[model samples]
Target chain A: MPEPIDFYFDFSSPYSYVAANLIDALADRHIRSVTWRPILLGPVFEVSGNRPLNAQPMKGDYMRHDVPRLCRRHGIPFAWPEPFPIATVAAARAVYALWDQDAEQAIRFAKAVFRAYFANGRNIGETDGVLAVAADEGIDAAALGQAIQDPAIKARTKAAVDHAIKLKVCGAPFFLVDEEPFWGVDRLPLMDEWMARGGW
Target chain B: MPEPIDFYFDFSSPYSYVAANLIDALADRHIRSVTWRPILLGPVFEVSGNRPLNAQPMKGDYMRHDVPRLCRRHGIPFAWPEPFPIATVAAARAVYALWDQDAEQAIRFAKAVFRAYFANGRNIGETDGVLAVAADEGIDAAALGQAIQDPAIKARTKAAVDHAIKLKVCGAPFFLVDEEPFWGVDRLPLMDEWMARGGW
Candidate 1:
């Protein structure tokens, strides 16, 4: 059987939010599933010397205009969150914690967190926001709170980020299919073609 | 009549090479013409605090892999040119020179320059290389050489770069349609849709 597509993302990324909303349907059409792996961009940025999309000068301005237009094109809801690019450690850890218990529920929670931050403008940078999104997903908020603080979950999230860095995952919404890397939400169509044609 | 699509590109960019090969056709599909404006990214990068894609850490590696994959997908010939990301001033100035004399030949010269550097590993950073490409395009090499050195042509090139900076064109393969901005070759699909639907 073909392996599931590896989907890596962070909560602080606007493009990731768009890719997250679309990857599943693309995968489903090809009779494939996605393994949603949450990661922190902090360490990845440190290694790559890359800054958040909203932090650069002209590129930041371009992204601000481009992201909304992209979201509109895809019929995805998006708004620039306040205090943009908040720490995503809390959100990443929560996903890792839930992942250990229920993989499907973890994906649902991740989706909720993305929608909360990007669509609803809720900051998912802090523990409170993470738990709030979790609760809304019908996840046990207190258990999630404890799990986020659990050293094991924190280490798992860190390890995942380290793995991403090792794989040179420089951007969020990066994907690995058949060990081929595809980055950016804009790559979704190419990735779809790659899956359909089995590489060229 | 629809305003011509403003295609801003630099010779040093790989994505620009790919986009340059495809954009005219995309424009033709929408019954639009393209104004191929060659601008140096040096000043724009200075304003944006941006570095070349190959100068970064992991992102550079990703670009190296991505560019070839994209070329293959589009059936465009590509090879990582020796001394990649060379100074494009001479090439830009030559384009301006050819443009004033013959618009169609100027575009043919630009496309040849892109093909020269990207497909055949030719170095287009020097005046001689630019002249050779111009000559290959059946342009008068000696006349083109004199024009490239003309103070008026130099100023025109510089002014074009300034105008791009003013428009916040922070990257190559950037497009401005109906005064709306789209950046990156990945944005080509979106640009097509925007032109088709007349914006959303």
Candidate 2:
């Protein structure tokens, strides 16, 4: 069996939301599993002197137009979140907490969070919103609240961000297949080809 | 008949070199012609508070790895320029000069300049280097030298940059199809689809 692809993403990223919708199916086709690693872009942005996509002048405008168009092209459902680039700390911590108990459940929970934020247009930045999404995935809301605040889970989430920075992951929807880094959801085609050919 | 696609590029951008290799063929397939507009990115960068791709921290490193990988994938010849992000004023001016006289030869000259700088790893930043590439494309070296220095040609090149900025063209390989702006070479697929579907 080949190495599992490392899929790094942040909860607030629409591009990550799009990648989440596609990566699993793509990986299954290649007989590979994906390891979803939820990360926070806040610290990464601070360190890299980068701003959120919507904050950048020209790029922000382009992304706003492109995201929906891309969603339509891929046949993925999407609704733009209002007050975009919300805090993703609560979502990340919850994913880290659930991951320790059940990786599959964590993946499902993360996808739910993405849908809530990107598809349903709910604000995942709010703790209640994140918990509601998790509950929809069959995770107990009260238990998840405690786990999200657990010191260990908080550390794990921070560690994920630190790991991302160490790996030079400057963008969401970044992938590492056999340690070959590929950034952006746009690079997915190349990633698919790379996996099929086992590297070029 | 469709409006000719405006291909906005900066000679110093590797992504532009990659797009330059593919845009014409992609346009031809749609029975559309392309208007290559070589603009200087220096002023655009200054206004946008952006740096060259290689100057950004992780993104720079990723671009270095990606450009070659993409070139190989597209079957386009490429070699890393020693001192990339070189000044493209002379080349742009020469292009504008030749464009005023013979548009087809100007396109050939621009392609030659791109091939010299990106594929052959020659320094087209220098006036002599630009002249050599132009001469190789059947342009008169002496006449081209005078034209490249003509104030009108220099102003035309500057005006092109101003026009690009006005269009919110923040990156190289930007395309304007029927006044719909698309930035980055990666966006070509969408542009192709947009043209095919007559916008979505």
Candidate 3:
């Protein structure tokens, strides 16, 4: 069996939201499993001298228009969050906490958080909002909130970002198929071809 | 008939090189023509606070690897120039000059210049290099040199860049189909689909 593809993403990234919608079906088509890893792009961007996509000047303007058009093309639900690019630290911590207990539940929790921010326009930056998302996924809101504040879970979230940075993942929706790094949801087709053909 | 798709590019961009190889055929398939506009990205990048892909740290590292890999996927020939990202002022001026004389010859000249820099690793920055590329395309080197130096042709090049800026073109290999903007070579597929479907 082939190694499961690693998907690294940030909760606040629109491109990551697009990838989250498609990656599972894409992986299933190849008869492969996917490992979703929620990462904090704040520290990574700091070290790389990059800003959030919507924070950059013209790029921000372009993305504001492009993201929804892309969602339409892909047939995915999309709604711009009211306060764009809200901090995802609490969301990342919650994902890590759930991941320790159940990887599948963690994925469910991550999708819920993405939908809350990108589909429902809810701010995932707040602990309460994230707790609500966790609750929707059948996780205990109070326990998840406590776990998010736990030092071990906090360290795990930090470690995930650190690991992504070390791997030179400067962008969200990054995928790694046995160490071959492919960045962006735009690269998904190429990643699919790479897996299908066993590296052309 | 649909408006000709506007292909705005910079000579120094690797993605532009990739797009240059494919745009014409893509247009032909859709029964549409392309208006190839060579625009300088220097001023656009400055105003938009953008840098060359290879100038950013981690993105630079990734692009150095990604460009060649992308070339292979598209079955296009690519060779990184010795002095990558050479100033394209002379090349752009020369292309504009030839464009005034003969549009077909101008495209031939532009493609030759792209091949010289990207496939042969030749420097198109120097006046002599661009002159040689023009000569290879059946243009007179000395006459082309004089035309490149002509104030009118220089203004044309500047005007092209200015016009692109007015259109909010912040990146190279930007495409405009019926006034809708699509940025990046990765977007070529989307652009193609948009043309085919008459908006999706």
Candidate 4:
């Protein structure tokens, strides 16, 4: 058995999507597996005073240049999703719906949300967007939509965000392998190495 | 001649030194060289709300794991400087003094300071340690010491810090490659590729 690496992610972050793309390979190694703990990144930024990269000219410049190039390196096409930082509330609710019934399905929806925002520039805040992805996952879209409105699911997702803050997560795609948190996607190589040394 | 890339650096920044080590080789084919812009990361942080990696536990852990490994890749030894975020006011002043008289000497001394503080746990903030590095670059220790205390040099360094704040550099080791600012060392490959393709 391998250590379950907990990943704190969000659809609003391009880095999270990039991290999602490589997560399967990470899990397949048998050295570690990902526990996708989707959190709202907005609160993380609020307390930490971090704005979106698009908000700062310097950081924005790096994002436009570096992120697409990074995606290109991974042989993935990329673009900024429209309605940046789309309301992840609905997406979060759907994630909770699949938390137990179907884990792979949950991850699929998560990836879909990320791709819609970062790669396709779609508005994930729209119910239709979330439902379309849910339908594609073979889940009952209407039921999923209703479940998304549940207070318990809302609380669950918010608690994850609170837990992320307690864990000191300041960025998206934060990975914790054996309680050691790696914050940025750029640190993946090191995370891979550390997991390997841990008998991955 | 390649247009000179402005490298905004802070003496206490390990990433800046690591990036600087490769700046030359990466820019070999470019028409512009590098113009070392000594800036204070502290002021940049004051405006942007980014603290030292060590100050932010989660981000700090990521840096500790990722950077030492990158240093190893660059064939540089690794260690976290003791008393992290050692004052660079004095060190910055010394570099400003030597900036015009000897850009190469100034760069060497700045790098030595980074290595000493960030790799060897030595305090470049103090007079003796920085002077020791200056002597290694064949500079007069006494003259350099006097330069450190010069009001003009100190004021110039202050201005540099303020300038970085205005430029919106939120972190250490930001660079401007052909007028496009890249905030982290990880952005180098893309910036280089752009320069290769005339993206600059």
Clash count list over all predictions: 0, 0, 0, 9
Q: Write the per-residue lDDT of candidate 1 for residues A1-200, one digit (tens) a residue.
A: 67899999988888999999999899998999889988788888898888887878999999888888888988998888997888999998988888868999999999999999999999888999999998888899999999888888888888989999999998898999999999999999999999999999
Cα error, residue A177 of model 2, in Å, equals: 1.0
User: What stretches of model 4 exceed 4 Å from their correct place?
Assistant: A1-5, A25-34, A46-79, A126-128, A193-200, B20-33, B60-75, B127-129, B151-168, B192-200
**lDDT of each residue in A23-42, candidate 3, tens digit only:** 99889988888888888888
Cα distance off (Å), candidate 4, residue A114: 1.7
Model 1: how far is A165 from its true place, Å? 0.1
lDDT of each: 0.91, 0.88, 0.88, 0.77
Task: Report the TM-score of candidate 2, chain B only.
Answer: 0.98
Writing each residue's lDDT as its tens digit, candidate 4 over B16-106 gives 8798788877867685667777787767766655577766655665567667767876787668777667777788888889989988887
* Alpha-carbon runs more than 4 Å astray in model 1: none
Model 2 ranges off by over 4 Å: none
Q: What is the interface RMSD of each candidate, in Å?
A: 0.8, 1.6, 1.1, 4.7
| Residue-level lDDT tens digits of model 3 in B38-86 | 9888899887888887888888888988899999998988988989788
Better of 1 and 3 by lDDT: 1
Candidate DockQ values, in order, are 0.89, 0.57, 0.71, 0.31
Between prediction 2 and prediction 4, the one with superior DockQ is 2
Using TM-score as the yardstick, the better of models 1 and 4 is 1
The stretch of ten residues in a row with the least summed lDDT in candidate 4 chain B is B54-63
Q: Give me the displacement of residue A145 in model 3, in angstroms.
A: 0.7
What is candidate 1's lDDT per residue for B149-172, written digit by digit as tens? 999999999999999999999889
